[model samples]
Target: MREVAFITQNKEKWLNFEQAIFHRRFKDPDELATLYIHIINDLSYAQTYYPKSRVIAYLNQLAAKAFQSIYRTRRQDTNRLLYFFRTEVPLTVYQHRRYFAYAFTLFFIFVAIGVVSAAHDDTFVRLILGDGYVNMTLDNIKNGDPVAVYKSGSNWGSFIGITLNNIYVSMRAFVYGIFGGLGTGWILLQNGIMLGAFQYMFHAEGVLWESVRGIWIHGAMEIFSIVVTGAAGFILGAGILFPKTYSRKTSFKMAFKDGIRILLSTIPFFIAAGFLEGFVTRYAGVMPDMAALIIILGTLGFISYYYLIYPFIIHRKTVNSL
Candidate 1:
């Protein structure tokens, strides 16, 4: 690229970085690091092609300033928790939003397959959910309470156990990314199929709406968190599979960090789901329909906004600001 053309093309971006640094406008470390990476790439290009030009010197100085700024700001944030939820996670989500879509698509497809299979074969639900569970649920349904299984456990014990199990499942989903994402896909498929078949069982028993009111009260957040964790796994797998301009190690490291951040973001939601399952779901039978709808739709809307809509809004705002 010609020096003049290069400068012209990137002048606005460079100026935005300058303004951000000088005015202390950067909102997060990730944003600053992103700008620093772009500046360093430009610096490398300038040094290679404009060896004798003033642009090389200019880029070097700019790069130095960015490095110093990033370094100086690199301290343990006292509000690390707040900053992570407010900025870091959202930005990371925005950057890898496509992976979220991929995960959801894979899960939905698996769910459809499960529904169709269960519809055709009476034994399919039992196979996926295990014969023991299927028998227990059948007993519960015959006893006039299909979701009575949820009500059997002590509330606090159930909360603690469910929370731990959810965290474990999420961690498993994330760690399985080491198998090049196939493991993550398997996890999603298993869970999605189980869910579809479970719902179908209720439908077959003529209690589909009753099951929805009870199950989805907590399942909304629980299922969505699982899907998000799957996306995290794919993010890590993609780093190993397609390193792009980065070396495999570097790409994997970056992916691992981002994936961990994304995975961490789901923890709170998992806990909430657990709480709902332990405390609220037990009362699903007696709870007013409006109350159940509020919990179910509210959880769905919140997760959808944060994971899906808010990320896009944040990305657009960041771009516009730049």
Candidate 2:
């Protein structure tokens, strides 16, 4: 493109970025960094395509200003934790919202497959859930407490163990993106299938409502975190599979950073799930039906709103402000 055309095309965006920096309109450091990257790319193009033009010098000056704005040290905010949850995570989620959709679609499809297979084959639940688990659950059902397995351990011990296990699972889902997301998909498939078969087993035994009331208190958060981690894996994998405007190395580095943040965001939810499972799920058999429903639905609603709805709300506000 001609120098004039290039300048005309990007001038408005550059001006907006300048206003964002000078007026302090950016939502967070991440947004500033993103703008800086764009500025750097524009500067590179100017140098390469219009080296002798005044636009090159102008872009260099603009890029330098943006760099300083982004990297300059400022007093650390005391409310860093609040800022992260309120701004950083939601912005990142908004940016990669489609990956969340992809993860959910893949998981649901696997769940459907599991449900169909289990319905067709009597041994399917055992295969998916493992013979030992199926047998133990069968014994529990015979003894009149199908979910009694949750009551096996001390509450605090179970909480710690389950929380640690969930963290490990999420990390695996994230790190396995090094395999370009197949590993993460495998993890999701395994979990989704097990969930489907397990639910089917309870339904076949005529205790679907009982099982849901007992399991979903914690399962809501746990399952949602799993799906989010799957999305994180896909974000990482996409860095390799589809680098778009960036080099593969650059894309992967960016993806890894964002993926880490996304994975970290799930820790609290996992802990909450652990607490519910360790304490609440054990009493699910005795808990009032209405109370159980409230817990399950409330947890589900919180996860859905935070991960799915809040991001879009933040995005819209940010865009409108810009």
Candidate 3:
């Protein structure tokens, strides 16, 4: 069937299913389960025949919602927390993939801006990274240990401090969405610029590779989590900016629900990043090149797959199994 015809045929049923799930006044677990089966059947058909159509994604969202509602009416046979992390977060992240794209795009663009600006203006690095940090790093470079900053604090103290600071940064990235996402964008811009300038400073001092080996040991997870948090912020902002078919208040509430879930998913990642920064990144300069490379790629690959790739896998598997 043509995509348009398929959507036209099932669209009303999908909308009704959505309404039935959203309104608590009319919830019936058994009845919703019946409707959910129908929705999944349609979703599987859409997946097989209309694989490229947006309808697949739309149906997937409905299927997820319906499944949540149906489960709400029943006792859990499985661990709810495991199900939430393993399934729910991935599905919701898939639905908001565009926000991820937007956040990363803005961050990279600003990073480029920082690189270019700093390359031409020596003072730009000082301005973004602060004079004290610039001076300290320069001194460390002279001492033949550019990453010595990470070694200054005790490992346990650094891990605790870094983890707390990471959480604070992520919360700000998420909470700023109330201003319509621009605040989150600003945070991304600032961080991106600082990163770019900081790296360029190393390059100018003939230690680009030296810096990468140590910095990326933990920088991989730390930076990726921030970008993901920024996406969550965008999700929050999107609700306020585009309240289609729902009141502004209702839309904001829905956005907050999903946004917070996205934020919650990053907690473990932030902790991992902090541990690496405190205990590992400091030794990047002296550690074996192969070992440092593994840590960097391993952390980067793990988080990237979770947020960027795993969602489709779970969503597709859930739809097809039904």
Please, what is the whole-model Cα lDDT of each candidate in the order they appear? 0.85, 0.84, 0.86
Index of the highest-TM-score prediction: 3
C-alpha-based local distance difference test score of model 2: 0.84
Predicted candidate 2 versus true structure: per-residue lDDT over 1-322, tens digit per residue: 9888988899898888877865678888678767867877888898898778776655654554454344332324568787677667777787678889999999999888888989999999988788999999998988989898999989999999999999999999999988999999999999888888899999899888888999999999999999999999998998889765447997798789778889999999999999999989999999999999999999999999999999878656554432
How many pairs of residues collide in model 1? 0
Clashing pairs in 2: none
Clashes of 2: 0
Ranking by lDDT: 3, 1, 2
After superposing candidate 2, which stretches have Cα over 4 Å from the reference? 1-77
Instruction: Quote model 2's TM-score.
Output: 0.80
RMSD of 2: 7.4
Which one is best on lDDT?
A: 3
Model 3 C-alpha lDDT per residue in residues 1-322, reported as the tens digit of each score:
8878988898798878778877743546667777778888898998899788777766766666654455446535478788778777887888788999999999999899999999999899999988999999999999999888989889989999999999999999999989999999989998999999999999999998889999999999999999999999999999999876568998899889989999999999999999999888877777999999899899999999999999989667654544
TM-score of every model?
Answer: 0.79, 0.80, 0.86
Question: Where does the lowest 10-residue lDDT sum fall in candidate 2?
Answer: 67-76
Candidate 3: regions farther than 4 A off: 1-15, 24-64, 67-77
Question: How many Å off is the CA of 250 in candidate 1?
Answer: 0.6
Scored by lDDT, model 1 comes in at: 0.85
* Candidate 2 residue-wise lDDT at 274: 100
